[model samples]
Target: MSARLTQRQRALQKFIEILVNLKGQMCGLGIPLVAAFENIGKENTGGVWSDIFMQCSSIMKERNINAGEAWKKALENNKNIYLDECDYEQLWDFGERLGKSDRLNQEKVLELEKEKLTIMEKKAREVAETRGKLYRSLGALTGAAVVILLI
Candidate 1:
């Protein structure tokens, strides 16, 4: 139980570090969104996401990770790719967003994404610092209680 508590909190810490590095590269090197995504995904995930586009295609039919897949499709086709577009929102599949008229510029989307992620990073930092300790304590206390009850 304590391990679970620690694992979850550690994942959040990793998220913060990864997001910062991602934003750093974007601001520092000015790489394209697709290249950035590919590079970050591969580098951060340790090759689990080496070909995120291909992985996104495999996950397309599933409901999860739709926005991510949409991002991949936009890049693969060299079209503007907003994180979310209403016209493409209800399309129900990754393929539908292709060649759409309503897509936003990738650079603009990247800027917005970074801004949003900056705010998210701040919030994540708070949670990682405070809530993690609270949760870990609770987990340990709960385990102790269980042991007491068993004894």
Candidate 2:
């Protein structure tokens, strides 16, 4: 479970990085949000990150909603089974603030979320490394003891 959680955190970190890049392309390169999402989606391709962005783009194009609402809607529609409540909370916060202000502010929000996810990923990795080994060792010992008793 810890390993799976670590993977999810890493995926989220990559997702945030993509969002940062998407923001840069929109702000610095003057690309439209829908086009930017389509471009980024093509570049990243395959994975929940791409799917979420593509969905957001689709929602924005079809419904004429703002980026934040589209983002929140995409996240809600595609539930990540691996992520826990805390992870969802952070993601929800990010979705709430996305595209609500200037480019700099949006970048700041992405950066902060990235930092928080980094810390969480590190902690989850540590737990997986330590506790995973312990669990395996305990299971082996228990098996050996049972065999000895049976013999």
Candidate 3:
């Protein structure tokens, strides 16, 4: 509704666009930045989508802008024209967590694989023992038949 709100809206919109571009510009830079951006709206910016919305709302209550109409108009005509600094620390923290989780998962998988191999080896040994018993039984039966025939 008001010119100030309109300008702020454009600024915030441009900031979001810049953030999106910056996220893809680097391989390791994007994910943490995007996550931090999400937190910005929730944690820093009064849980609103942008500061422009909050500004326009305050203006509307005081008859500065036309009660949410300007907010809608700003959305239509907004352009992002700036790049803001990202929260590097949070990104690093998230990446660290991801790295640790990946390592733990790989270790667990290897442990399971080793256990599976051991079980397979034990099963093979059991099968070999059974086969040996069967062969001995057959040999003894054959010897008994020969002895009986001779007697």
Candidate 4:
């Protein structure tokens, strides 16, 4: 479970990186935000992250709402099984600032979120490694004890 959590955190970090790059593209290349999100959804298929981006893009295009609101709605519509409440809260905070400011400010928000996720991912990786080893050792000991008792 810890390993899965680490993977999810890593995925989220990558997603934020993509968002930062896409934001840059939107500013530099004059690409539409909806198209950027669509591209991200296309690039990252077969994941909850992709679904969120696609949903956000659809909402933005259909309802003509701000990106923050679209992101919040997308998050609400798609629940990521791997993430916890704290992770969801962080994501919600990030979504609150999405497209609510200038390009630099948006980039700053993404970078800060990325930094936080990086730290969290590292900590989760350590816990997964340590706890995995401990669980394996405990399992082996339990099996040995059971065998001894039976013999």
List the lowest-lDDT window of 10 residues for candidate 4.
1-10
Best by lDDT: 4
Q: Predictions ranked by TM-score, top down?
A: 4, 2, 1, 3
Q: Counting only residues 3 or more apart in sequence or on different chains, how many pairs clash (N, Cα, C under 3 Å) in candidate 4? A: 0
Task: State TM-scores per candidate.
Answer: 0.43, 0.76, 0.24, 0.76
The parts of candidate 2 lying over 4 Å away from their true place are 135-151
Model 1 residue 121 CA deviation in Å: 2.0
Clashing pairs in 2: none
Model 1: CA > 4 A from native: 1-54, 57-69, 72-105
Candidate number that wins on lDDT, 1 or 4: 4
| Candidate 2 local lDDT, 1-151, one digit each (tens) | 5456556756665775776686678667867677777777777443667887788889999999987788778878878646767877777777777666776776677678778877877766676688777877888899999999999
Error of 3 at 134 (Å): 1.1
| Runs of candidate 4 exceeding 4 Å displacement | 45-47, 135-151
lDDT of each: 0.46, 0.74, 0.39, 0.74
Evaluated at residue 5, the lDDT of candidate 3 is: 38
Give the C-alpha miss distance for residue 53 in model 1, angstroms: 4.6
